[model samples]
Every structure is written in C-alpha cells, then in structure tokens.
Target: MTTSIRGTANADVLTRFRRSAHWKPLEYAFWCLPVLAYFAFPGNYLLLSQIAITGLFALSLDLIFGYAGVISLGHAAFFGVGAYTVGLMGSHGWSDPLLGLLLAALFAGIVGFLSSFLLLRGSDLSRLMVTLGVALMFFELANKLTRITGGVDGLPGITIGPILGVFDFDMFGRTGYIYSVVVLFVLFWLARRLVRSPFGQSLRGIRMNALRMPALGVPVNRRLVKIYTIGAAYAGAAGALLAQTNQFVSLDVLSFQRSADLLLILILGGAGHLYGGLIGAVVFVVLHDQLSDLNPQYWQFWLGLILVLLVLFARGGILGTAQQWIESRRQRTQARQRAGSTS
Candidate 1:
C-alpha cells in the first residue's frame, strides 16, 4: 500500500513538472544529469568519459540503422581508424586536440569512402557480412603489423602533450571528462541539426522504403553512400575522443565484440529515439561498474539477466517506460475528472 502511494505521488510530481513554466529548464537539466553525476562521483569519472564516447559511437549507428535503415557489423572499422590516427599523431609530435579531431574525422571519412562501394550494394545480411569482413580484415592487418599497430599488446606511450600546450589532461580525469563532454556536446548539436534537415528526411524515407525514395528521385544508393560516410566519420570522431582522453589505443577498440556491444546499447535504448544511446550507455556502464565491483566473474551473467528483463518488459528502456507510465496516469486522471463532472 505504501509503495503504491509513493508511486502515485511520484507520478503527480512528474505531471506538475510537465505543466510548470520551469519545466523547460528542468528538461535541459535532465540532459546534464550525467555531467552532474560525473562531478559528484570522481571515482567513476573515467568510466563516465568512456561511456560518453561509446554512446556517441552508438548514436552514429542509430543514425544509420534506425534512421537510414543501414545495417552494419563493422562500424568499428572507422572507430579503429580514428583511434589509430590519433595514436599515430600523438606518438609523432602533434598534440592539438581540435586538429587531432579533424584528422580523425578525415581518416575515418577516407575509410568510409573506400568501403562504401562494398557496402552500397547488398541486402541487410550482405551489408552486415561485408561490413563485418571489413572490420575483421582491418583488425587482422593491425595485428599483423605489430611493429606499427602494436599488435595484441596494444598501442601505448601516447601523450596529448597538454591542451593547447598549457592545460594537461588532468591525471585526475577532470580535464578528460570536460574535454569529452565538450566534444560530445558539439557532435550532438551537429547530429540534432542533421536529423532535422532535408537530408535527414530523405534518409528516413529511404529507411521506410528504398523503392519509394528512388521513385521520388532521391538517388537511393547515392544518398545511402553519403549518409553512411557521415555516420562513419561520426564513429571515428568518437574513437578519437576516446584515444585523446586515454592517451592509449588498443585492439579492443576494433573488436567485433565492441561493435556488437554498441548495437546492443542501441537496441536497449530504442534505436529511433535520441536519448536512447546516452541513456543506454549510462545504464550499461553503471551496471557494469557495480557488478564488477561486486563480482567480476558473474558480471556478464547479471547483465545478461537484465537484458532478458528489458527485452521481456521494457521495449523502450527506462525513459520510455517512465514516459508510458506518466501518459497512462494522465489519461486515467482526465477520465476520472470527466466522469465526476458528469455525475
């Protein structure tokens, strides 16, 4: 009974919040909650930084898969290329964060350009296989060239040489977190605009029905190629973000498992929604952190269990579930008020 009362009270508060003039600011505040949490918990700041990068990468995938109807199993190919570009730059003598980002995007774009021919033709299944093959081939090549790629031992000895040669990536993760947040915010702004643009609409139309898009003169394959290139560049930028913050590059960045995990995050959060990637990343990281702290051996099993529950009950994730509950309550309340007035 107490639990039910509290639930009702929470729902009432949410309804009021939705109606309040302060609600708009509060909505923005909600977006910054992760940033606030990072400051609140310094011990977990590093993990948060990583989660943000991964989320951006996943967001790139959502843009393609959910919005553009592109299926890929080798998205990590661009990510790896981005990471390596940064690694290679840092190890040489370059250290400007902004410049490094551009190089990362540029390199990733090149990779996308090269692979788009293979990706542009093929069913979802074929695209998946081809993309997967590309990533795997890249990983293998990196491993084979151990002297340059660092092989299985991974790339180390990378240093960003300080931001603008003044501020360093705070050994405490403060600089890293702030840097990542800034980059993510910029990318997200660009993504927001991209999604609302005419180009974005075309991609959605293509996703809905490639046949219809072309009949309407959308040049379906060309649009797909272009959007896929953009998405790849975004993924690469995400990888570069990680590399800059960590000052290290590893094979794990290119692993099929990493690509698969990003896909899972997208699914867990609901692909078409914007917040899905960010929310999913937070949940995945927090749960992984907590479970690892408790028992690393069984963390995967526990996460698997959570996925099962999410699949069975929460189709839209926590945010989606909350929204549904709130809407349902509003509907019920309005019905009750109408019936009472009639009586």
Candidate 2:
C-alpha cells in the first residue's frame, strides 16, 4: 500500500517514525504540554477547551479525508445528532457525563454506519452531494421537529450534569474546559493509536486501490464502513463535548459552515499527518478569534485568501513545509560532508 507521503525520503518519515529516539521525549511533551499549560493559566481555560473541541471535530474529518481518502460533506449530521442527543437526554434529566459521551458515540456511529452506503460511492463530486444532502436533511429535520428539537428557537435551558458526579460546571467555565481537554486528548490518543495499527494500513491500502483489496480477500467495503462509523463517533463525541461545555444546543452547531470550517482546518493542517488536524484547528480558531475581534467581515475574506494560498502553495501545510526544508537541509549537509571527507 502507498503511504500518504510521496517520494522516497518522505516515505521514511512515516516508516521510521520511532527510529529517532529523540522524538520520543518530544512526542510525550507535545501531549503533556497542552494539559500543563491549561492547568497553569486559569483565564485561558475557556479558550483552550473550545480549541480542543474544534480540534476534535476537525480530527474526525482528518481520519476519513486524510487517512481514508473519503470526502464527507454531511459530517455535521453526526455532530448534530450527538449534540441533539445530549439536548434530548438533558431534557429528560439524564446528565451523567460518561453516559452522554457513550450515547454520543452510539448515535453518531449508527448514523455513520447508515450513511456509509452513500459514503462508499466515494466519487469526489457524488460524495460531496451525498454528504451535503445528509446534513441538509438533518438540519431541516431539526427545524421540522419543533416539539422535540425546540425548532428555530433552539432547545435552550440544557443543564449538563457534573463531571463524573464531582465537578459542577460553573459560570467561569472551568469544568467545561477541563472536561473537553481530557476527553479530547483521550480520543486523540486513541486516534493516534488507530492509524498506527494494522487497520490504518488497511485503510491506506483501500484508499489506494479498492478493487485490488477485495480481489486480495480484504473486505474493502467493511473497512470503509468501520472507519466511517468511527469517524462519525468522533464527530458525535465532539458535539457532545461542545454541548456539555456550552450547556446549550443550537441548530447552527450542525450547519454546513461547521463542516466547511472543519474541512478548511484539515486542509490547512495537511491531513494524513496525525498532528495536522489539531495544528490547523489551532491556527483557524486563533485566526477566527483575532480576526473577529478586529472585524467579522474582513476575517472571512482574509482567512479565505490565506486558505487559497495554502492549498495552492503548501502541499503538507505548515508542518509539511518544515519537514521538507529540514530534510532538504540535512541531505545537503550530508552530501557536503561526504564530498569533503573524500577530498
């Protein structure tokens, strides 16, 4: 199976991931550093938490789009389903955090599984239409089911339960941030493990050639279904996290813009790279925050321009470029040393 990276040396990046013992400590620090920073700065809790939630959502897309080569426009369907599930559950006074999370995953997974037939078609344009159609149907349903969904007015007054029956969500947003970060990291770790496993290789193989995989006795369709369901669960879990933090559910949360925004993030981060989704999410959210503060109208325009530049010029996004430059420099230095030693 062909890996995401192109060219000989680029392949080494994925294959030799653990060869550099130096990266081990840094990789550990990468996960730990954020949590540490979150703890250190009380005021930044809300920001960090929200960022993690968005990052998780984007990560879902990365799993499918980046790893599985599947393009989905209806991602918001699962996200919305997860959010509305939480809202519905809260209305019934079912607010245990774990229950909500589990329900979110179940609901999203089912939705994803059901939607896999559409996703399996896998034509870029057809997949877009199918995915977008699903999201639109969900959005309209939310409006039509006013009695249950609260309709356009939104299902307000949701009361999320305390964390593990311990930390009560407060006005200062402490619990929300911590809950989001912890859950986000746990799942993020799971995602990392997933793509590293044999399943991940199967996905890459399927992405490269669906016809060959089935002929070779691999269940191509089944893998697609499994990964789609997993991705949907990730999206749904993200929605649940968002609902728990905000204590409010709105139809807007499941809109096309959310899905579109997530796509932009993954593209910007250079999907297929495990860290790409989060990196893109951070850049996007930070840009949104800063730009919105300056002027809402201009933010979209400027960010859009930046995105065009990225898609056109940056193949691997920021990290990809850095990796390329480092590899190039290393190659040059090695060549120079070899020449001098021979001289």
lDDT of 2 by residue, 53-153 (tens): 98899889888888888887779999999999998898788988789989998999999999888767757788889989999999999999999999888
* Model 2 alpha-carbon drift over 4 Å, by segment: 1-23, 39-41
Worst 10 residues of 2 by lDDT: 14-23
TM-score of each: 0.87, 0.90
TM-score of 2: 0.90
Model 1, total clashes:
0
Off by over 4 Å in 1: 1-27, 319-343
lDDT of each: 0.83, 0.85
lDDT of 1 by residue, 1-343 (tens): 9999999998986675445323256458866777787768887668878888988898888888878988888899999999999998888888787789899999898888779888777888999999999999999999999999898988888878677678788777778877887787788777766766667778889988988777788998888888888888999999998999999999988999989888888878777665677778878877878898898788899998998799679876766776789999999999999999999
Model 2: how far is 212 from its true place, Å? 3.2
